[model samples]
Target: MSVKENCQKIEERILKACQRSGRKREEVVLLAASKTQPVEKILQAYYCGIRYFGENRVQEGIEKIEALKDYKDIHWHLIGGLQTNKVKYAVKYFEMIHSIDREELVDEIEKRASKMNKIQEGLIEVNFGEESKYGVKEENLKKLFEYILTKEHIKILGLMAIPPYFENPEDVRPFFRKLRQLKEDLEKDFNVKLPHLSMGMSHDFEVAIEEGATIVRIGTALFGERI
Candidate 1:
């Protein structure tokens, strides 16, 4: 199917998921994970009414952002594991970073954003103690939040996670539930409101939305498999 057709189908699914979950369609943001896809494909999604796009790499995202600079309403997101060296470019280009899991990263972002004279928005990536995944452990999340609360240039909007894959999407529900619960706990503990839960992807986005995902990062289901 074409990108437009894929977008239509995904939109329908998002609407139905919202209905099933008794949530408003406007509440969920459909972020096109335009990692390796070319600008043409992103434009196709843009024409289909998608305004949010996520890139996994800082350099690639910078190129795409430059190429698509004329599209003023587009919101770019960095959704991969960000390195300290790349913090400057990532802060300058992307509107939000979705993989903040350490103090070093927070410090770098705060410094860069402060130099650029802008507040950088980000999400705290929570790893379920998976050695392979990149995120702060659940036990260490409070500590991370405490440190981030002292920073001036970067703001934590919510949480993001790449949960363990399950053939059946139902099995992933618990992980999503855990992320949401963590967000709730953080809000109460810090007396702050973290509004965005950047979880779920092509395979289990509907499940993510049902569990209070304000931002769903979808790629293959929208842009087809990467080449």
Candidate 2:
């Protein structure tokens, strides 16, 4: 199927998931994970109504962002692990950063945003599923949150996570549920409403949406498997 057709199918599935969970389709955001995808194909998805795109690498993402500069209203997101050295470019190129996992990275982001006079928005990535992953552990979230609040230039929009891969998407449901509950708990503790839950990928996005994911990251499902 073409990118447009793929997008239509994904949208239908997302709507179905939202309906099953008693949620409105508008409450959910579809972010096309465009890492390693060509500019032409990305444009195809763009024309098909995908305004939000995510990339994994800083350099590659910046390149695409530069190439697509003429495409107004395209919101670029950094969804993979970000390095401290790339914080400046990330703040300059992308509108949102989704992989903030540590205090040091947050500091870097704050410094760069301060220099640019821009308010940087990001999601706190929770590393609950794997030991070797790149997110802040669930237990340490509050400490991180508190520290982040002091950084006037950076705003923690919500939480994001990449659960362990399971052949059956059902197995990933627990991870999504936990992230949602964590969000609820954190909101109550901090008295702040997190508007975005950046979880789920192409394989298990429907389940993620069913469990309260406001933004679902989809790549292969929209752009086909990466070469």
Candidate 3:
């Protein structure tokens, strides 16, 4: 299918998920996970009415951002593990970082944002005890939130998680639910509103939306398998 057709199908699914969960369609942001996609394909998605794009690597994201600089309306997001050295460029290029899993990254983002005099918004990545994922464990989430609260230049917008993959999307529901509950618990504990839950990917986004995902990162389902 063409990008336009793929987008139509995805939009329909998003709408259905929103209806199932009694949420507004406008509440969820469809972020194209344009990790390895070429700039032309990215633009195809843009013309198809997708304004949000996510990149997994800082350097790749920078190249795309520079390439697409003329399209000022596009919102770029960093949705993968970030190295400390890339924080400066990540802060300057991406509107939000969705893999903040450690205190060091928080400190680095704060410093970079302060240097640039910009408020860097981010999501705390919570690991579901997955050995391979890069995220703070659920038990340490509060401590991380407390530490992040002290940073003047960085803001925590919500939580993100890349749950272990399951062929059945329903099996992933509990992980999404846990992430939503964590977001709620943090809001109550800190009296802050974290509005974006950056969870879900191509295979299970509908489930994520049903569990309160405000941002759904889609790649293959939108752009086809990576070339």
Query: What are the C-alpha RMSDs, in order, of all predicted structures?
Result: 0.6, 0.8, 0.6
Tens-digit lDDT track for model 3 on 1-227? 99999999999999999999999999999999999999999999999999999999999999999999999999999999999999999999999999999999998999999999999989999999889889999999999999999999988999999999999999999999999999999999889999999989999999999999999999999999998
Q: What is the C-alpha lDDT of each candidate?
A: 0.96, 0.94, 0.96
- Model 1 gets an lDDT of 0.96
Candidate 1 lDDT for residue 57: 94
lDDT for 214 in candidate 3 is 98
- Residue-wise C-alpha lDDT for candidate 1, range 61-98, written one tens digit per residue: 99999999999999999999999999999999999999
lDDT of 2 by residue, 19-74 (tens): 99999999999999998999999999999989999999999999999999999899
lDDT (Cα, 0-100) at 208 in candidate 1: 97
- Which regions of candidate 3 deviate over 4 angstroms? none
True lDDT of residue 146, candidate 3: 98
User: What local lDDT score does residue 92 receive in model 2, on the 0 to 100 scale?
Assistant: 96
The C-alpha stretches of model 2 lying farther than 4 A from their native spots are none
